[model samples]
Target: MKAAVVSNAGPDWEIREVPTPTPGPGEVLVRVRACGLCHNDVLVGQKRFPFLGPGPIITGHEAAGEVVGLGADVRNRRIGDRVGVPWMQGSCGQCAYCATDTSLTGQTAMGCASPRTTGVTVQGGHAEYVVASASGTVLLPDGLSYEVAAPVLCAGYTAWSALTDAAPGPNERVAVVGLGGVGHMAVQYASACGLETLVVTGNPEKAGTARELGAANVVTSGTELAEIGGADVIIAVTPSASQASEALQGLRRGGHFVVSGIFPDGSLDLGPRSTFWARRQRISGSTHAGPARLAEALDLVASGRVTPMFELFSKDRIEEAVTELTRGTSRFRAVITY
Candidate 1:
């Protein structure tokens, strides 16, 4: 099997032939068709994030592929089923966090934890083949394609889960900060949920694109936060924690700010003035959608409500893709197609 191996870990990626991965008990081997390149993968690979994916790891998590084989104890998931394997590969299921919500707890944390994950610590997507647990695989709906479903596994789920509070209603106002991976998806999901979406990006170039993605309004950081700009929910998808905190002032009282981005270093300053004084303002965080919610998000994609903005790259083009994204030259999303 050919994989975009991290090599020795750094800015570049090496696409090399590696032994084919096999499914273990309760696991399945997926012939990966497409894998989403997320910013989180970059941070983890470079060892800049809180914990680098255990090492000697492949660095993709948002993947969609066909199940070519199954492990000994795997059932329900058929051999030929096409599934979207997310960053959260699988969980203990019996853990207290799994019983509540995996997003709120770290028990099911994949991609960057001990016990590892399919691509990162365990081995990930970005390869021709990968392994995943039956519990973690979300069956792609009838009309969804692997390329289209790939990014939804991670970026899409993060945005959807953050914007919707697990459930968003019509007529709601949602504010999305940053127009990168999670931010772009956030705009689309907010629109799909019937909210008036507003985007806040520091870059002027993203203003038009943000509006195109479903944001009713778009403003650069230099621009004044609109007077009636308050939203029912403010999602900080920006990597800068401070910018997210500024978004809080843009939200109306009783609004919630959900942070999808994890600042590798500095904290988003949530000053005491507005963070606590507001009647219903709350600070919440959502990691990724669980299996059921991940399924729901894929359904959102199947409905055409949200489309991932991805640029396809071939195996040999892994280095270029990484460089472009690293240099901030790529627009929207980037995907590696096998």
Candidate 2:
């Protein structure tokens, strides 16, 4: 099978032939239809901080495909099942965190070093076929196709997982910082939950994009952000570490700031009272939405409530997609379709 493989930590991708493997016990072989190119791919390729790798790894996580074969012990899913493989592969349930149903909490995802995934390392869905553990495989409804469902595996899932930490009520004001892949979906999800949506982005173009995606108001960085002045919940989806930390000041008394963006190594300067004052604001982060949350994300998309705006790219043009994205030409998410 032809796969996009990273031969070494560099600034390019190499297309090479790799041996296709059969499904092992409790595993499924998915004929990949599409995969989303996330920011993490750039980090992994450049060997950025927090990307633990000295070796090459297949760098895709958001994938949707059809299961053509299954292992002998896999019983929960059947052949021909259309499944969306989330960033989470599967976690060892024996851990203390898993015993508390934290897996159900949309945390504890499988890493590249997992046992049931593909490649020598964690081979993701950047290839013709991918081997995924049957444990965390969530079935996509029949109506959704692989092309449209691909981004939901990561962007949509991450938005939902972070929003879970900020359950803004109808009366609360919700601010979504950075109208990128995950932030765009965060606006839609916040709107669906009946919160007043305000989008904050440094780019003015994204402000218009945010408004079109259900955000009632959009605020650029230059403005005073009067529309969402006292936001009860602020979800920072920008990959700017400084912005993520400073977002804690945008919340109301007793409000929460959920930081999920993975920016480069950096720091933030905020007031000492941001967390200690009467507001008693809190901050948390999430990796990606787990099984049930992914199901919810799909349902939201299917219902026409949350639509992921993405630019589609062919598998051969993977490099172009990454470049276009980093250059800010591609507006929302980018997907590599087969």
Winning model by lDDT? 1
lDDT of 1 by residue, 97-150 (tens): 556644411235732223345554567888899888877778899989998898
TM-score of each: 0.90, 0.90
Poorly placed runs, candidate 2 (over 4 Å): 49-56, 94-106, 110-121, 226-228, 272-276
Total backbone clashes of candidate 1, pairs 3 or more residues apart or in separate chains: 6
Candidate 2 lDDT, 130-225, residue by residue in tens:
888887677987788787788888888889888886777669888888888899889998888877888878777666677778888776641345
**CA lDDT, every model vs. true structure:** 0.76, 0.75
C-alpha RMSD for every candidate: 2.8, 2.9
